[model samples]
Target: MRSWGKSVDTMSSSSRSSQKENVSASRFGPKLCGYCNEFLSNLDLNFDQLNICGWVHSMDYHDIHKSARSGCQLCIVLRHDNTDPEDEHWHKAALGAYYKGRASIMMFLKSTSTTCYSAMYGQLSETISYPGTSRRQRVLDELDSIGAYHDLNYTPPKSTESQTAWELCDAWIKNCIKNHSRCKILHSASWYPTRLLYIGHFPTGYLDRDLSSFNVQLHLTQDKPPKGGYMTLSHSWGFIAFEMLKLTSETYEYRIKNGFSYIELPKTFQDAVRLSRFLRSDYIWIDSLCIIQGSEDDWIHESKAMVDVYRHSKCNIAATAAQGPTEGCFYPRDPTIVSPLEISLRLGGEEENPIPKKYLIVSDHSWHRSIEEAPLNKRAWVFQERILAPRQIHCAKDQLFWECNQTTACETFPFIFESHIEYSKGAAPLALNITSLDLTLSEMRKLRFCETRHDPFPGNFISYPQESSYSTYSNISRFDRTLAHLEGATIDEKIERLRRNIFLDWNNIISRYSSLELTYKTDRLVAIFGVASRVQEALKDMDIYVAGLWRSQLPWMLLWQIRISDTPPSYDCGPSWSWASFNRDVYFYAIPQPHDRVLINVDEAHDGHTVAKQGAASSHRISYLKLRCLLYKIEPDIAANSGKQSRTRFTTPTNPRLGFRPKSLHTDCTETDDYWHQAYIILVIGQHEENRLWGLLVRLCEEEPDCYRRTGMCWIDTEAEPNITEHVRGATDKDKA
Candidate 1:
């Protein structure tokens, strides 16, 4: 028989079972009975609604000799007499063997007798109607002929203990490397790091090799830096000595002279080095090993280069499965769990000839769950690492996951969803349409499309710009289109726009990052400094980038509110005016205000002590900030004050007190302490509530004399019995607004 195959692109998304209809009709029309041959000759196949299997298209109904039981490939294969249809073991084993080339499903079907195919066909008709079976069958029938379907009989050569993940990952990476348009990397020296560690050799099995064997530093000569790409390791240290493998004064020279032996490093690091070498890369950059851990100066310099290290690396090896440094990346995986199930159909009871077994690699959705909920994803540092890396291969516990700028894929669902495209249900005219757009915007719009937001404060809430139900959809769609439109324009300009937009959307990023775990609260700014630095580089103008706050975007930013927490942080790490001062959870919800209300007046000038002014250029490692702003002294309402809680109320020489909450009070005032008499507040922004007013509250930063930090947020509904007219009159500074 002549071989038959076609490119995957030729087939429709739902063309799995239907492809065979065309192929079989063209090849076997002469062998079928007259009626079957006539039906096959003029068959108008509906690509939209194909049969579950090709039997409907390949069978001869008139002649018993060429009946579906004997003539159809699918019917003949689905009736196995040697194995039980319900036995998963044989099913999985057969599927594994076929994938391993030890067995062939196509060959088996041709060789099997279809005399008893009717009984198996009936059983399949019953079970295949089940939703799970139907879904799996669709996925399997969809696989291209060239794809690997795992089998039980496959084994590695003696030189290799088992299959290495690197070979698979290398193949994937090499394929991606060829797509020049999508594979370009920024090689600018500023962010593109030069120095790296060269792990000893390649093609070496990691099973029993001594870690010490891979120890060599590849110091790139200034004239000739290695042309090929390098790999980076992003894993959690898990209470291990992160400061141990550093370039300190005492160890710097010795370490430079004597390269870092993999055996001395943690298991996670060792695995990373091995994987990098296997990926055909000459260099690997492990954070703890590359950076000077104990040296402050070296850390200050190298820490700023974090963006370059991750963004420029060819691939980031994430030890997603490992909880700590001690846990290695690779773990034993059961073939049964990894392999898809192969099911066979049985026909004609106990009296007839046996049929061939049909093979399928079942789709497992659990892989997505494992990847998303991986322990590594929970870390604050790893969050940035995962998002920044251009391409990353997650060494997960259940299965390996691949993520890039384009899409996220796992072994089970190889092509679940494209990153930049949208997919829909069913066949045309409602079929899937793939369009390029910002994935983030596309997702956010989906949420908005289905969500219904009700007016929370209907009575006397601010007269803010009321958003229609479809407003979010329109806004996000416009943003998405704008991004897509800038693709071929000046790259630098596009990057600058992306950077600025990222900063504009900083609220969402900060809200999530602040709640994550961090060993040192002071490192909050340093940890995200890489992200900030990248954004800064894209900016056409120089603006003050304070600890974790941007001076250019203080109005909306200053309204950040704290979420509930056990222990509120102190304000020593950063100025009280920034969220960086608070280590607890925070979020940004729009504070209702009039459409025309001006939040702050940047052009207006007041005395140095009274006007809002930015401090000097923020040093990457600095803690303090200097800002001058209008401050108002206020007294707390003792009855409404909640000790240490984010909720409270304060009165400004006015009858209607302003209700608010602060992450934490900084006056060293106990519940019984009369700090309310000395405490001061600033109105971040005022809202028009039924023509009345309300505002976001900020506590005075005493250290800076005039600057203030966000404590809590509030809305004053003056139309209610407890009026806020006096508070508004006292707090509103029209000139400042």
Candidate 2:
């Protein structure tokens, strides 16, 4: 059955072709050889030779312009002579070839009919056909009828510009490679060859999974921990492929086998140098020296490796004692420390040294001042500023032999002497316990100061006077006030002096709190003082005055609230009747009441007390009334309670229940002619506060009615007498019945 259907379709197609050929003959007259511009002249000529020759000519001279009107006549005649009627099989084959060519032409000429004839003649046969043509012409005519002819050779000019997808891809790849090559890479030991390159602000975690696919590791460092900063890798180009993969995963390991440890710096000068040398060793990495600080790109790249540097290092040697025991002790290193003998000899001879060497003599009393007052070389006695004082001996030792003249009790020489004195008070010491002249001076000062300032009172109290040592103490004593009174002090000097005293006091308080070690209490005190100082500074110009009250007493008020709340301090009690009362008196009276306009619209629905008690009320219920009050510059206090003693309330209703409700006997007011005549209803509703209803009522009153009247009552003069007898008779009859 399929074969039969195919045979029938073939027959129908052949019949349609025959009909199209007859139509072409009627329309174009005859077929002409495209190569010669002449009629075929013989239907029996060989078609294969002619078609092949035409195709070859079209391929060779397709773009060439000829001076003659059409192709060579001899070429067309030779093509016709090659055709023969005896070769019926060849003619049939030629027909099949033409049908195949027509199919291609139809496909190319689908958009325009003119292109079909042009393409067919230009390629197949270079001859002009008559208006009504042959078999080839019939095919062209049929294609034109179907609007399936278009010039395949026609192309639009290259005026429009657009990038192909592949071009964009190539450009992106090139940029990525360039970026990767220029960037630095950091590697992890665990990941080995898997490296990460620092890409600007690209997240490390995002690159982790991405780089992992390409066998690369992404490392990131956080200022605190867990996340932040940039990504790092081992090779510059590794990030390109890593980014291309678009990996997003955890880049850090939260749990590890080892715990955190601290690196301790050596105490001795020789040992400190040795430690510094060890840090500079090939295997060791010191960020300051190893990372290139001047290069922004280098810093950006190395910043991501900070986590690895700290985490993988033997230990981090935190230099807490870098700042010594004096103001500006953090001065840059120039005059280096040497042996104590060298420094002492350099100050002329020990005996010839004229400059007063000030030693800070800290004792239980005012020993420093007593030592200063001693009849020793006045020039040799100097007092060092004690801010950032060293807590350990090494730092003091480091400064002792330096060119600077400052000295402290913790230095090696001073330490040995003090230790000997301490032991001598209790037990016998070795020959090494012999104290130096300087040591003797320090001890004598300690003794004299103790005698005067450390006179134990009945309660073991000692009164230290201002004439004592110049050691800057935390306590604001008569000594500090006296110092402030000194003449010729500049603004910087005053500020510095004030800062010194304030810092001392602050440090002392911190020390006291530390001894107690109550974290919450310490934090509270710190926060209170810090916040108070901030507030004072911020409100320097404002008239607001903040009393220096103890935070412990007033637990309800926070420093932030005091600075930010709109209402004044008195109303700060948390939502109580007293707070409401305070708010009413203070805030309500802060702005003066307006009295020019007489008429008032009462939005009873939104009245605070009413809304709080009754849940249904719309926000816009009082809107119109509010507008009227605002127009007149009236002080429209919404929800005003009628009675004198009623509490001023402010509460919002829940969302579920809202809008107006029906009027009842419970409603506060009834229609009255006297007041109604003078007053206006800004709005009217079933409920008193409905602005829409009241607005309509007000409009009607303004336009239509000359005077207001009650629905069922008449206004009578106040002095009129009542008909008492008639009212009494009516009451009596009702009682008898």
Among the numbered candidates, top TM-score falls to: 1
- Per-candidate count of clashing residue pairs (backbone under 3 Å): 16, 39
- Our tally of clashes for model 2 stands at 39
Query: What residue runs in model 1 are displaced by over 4 Å at the alpha carbon?
Result: 1-164, 180-194, 200-214, 218-224, 242-248, 335-372, 415-501, 565-568, 591-596, 602-651, 654-675, 679-681, 686-694, 700-709, 717-737
Query: Please, what are the lDDT tens digits per residue for candidate 1 over residues 265-346?
Result: 7778777777776666777787776776676666666666677888778889999878888887877654333433344322
Off by over 4 Å in 2: 1-255, 258-504, 507-737
lDDT of 2 by residue, 1-737 (tens): 11111111223434433322331121112222232221221111222223322221111111111201133322222222222323322222111112123111100111111121111211111111111221344334422332222221212122111112112212222222232221111112331111222222222112111221221112232322222222111111111322222222221231111211112211221122222222231122223223443444554454433434332332222222222111111112111111011000111223443442211111111112222221210110011111111111112112221010011121112111222222112221111111111122222222333322221111111111222222322132322253556457644333333322332232222222222221122121222232223222322322121222211111111101111223332212111111111111111000001111112222211123212212332322110112212110011123443446232211112211111221211111233344223322221111111111111122123433542211111111112212311222233212211
Q: Could you tell me how far off, in angstroms, the CA of residue 433 lies in candidate 1 after the best superposition?
A: 22
Cα TM-score per model = 0.59, 0.15
lDDT of 2: 0.21
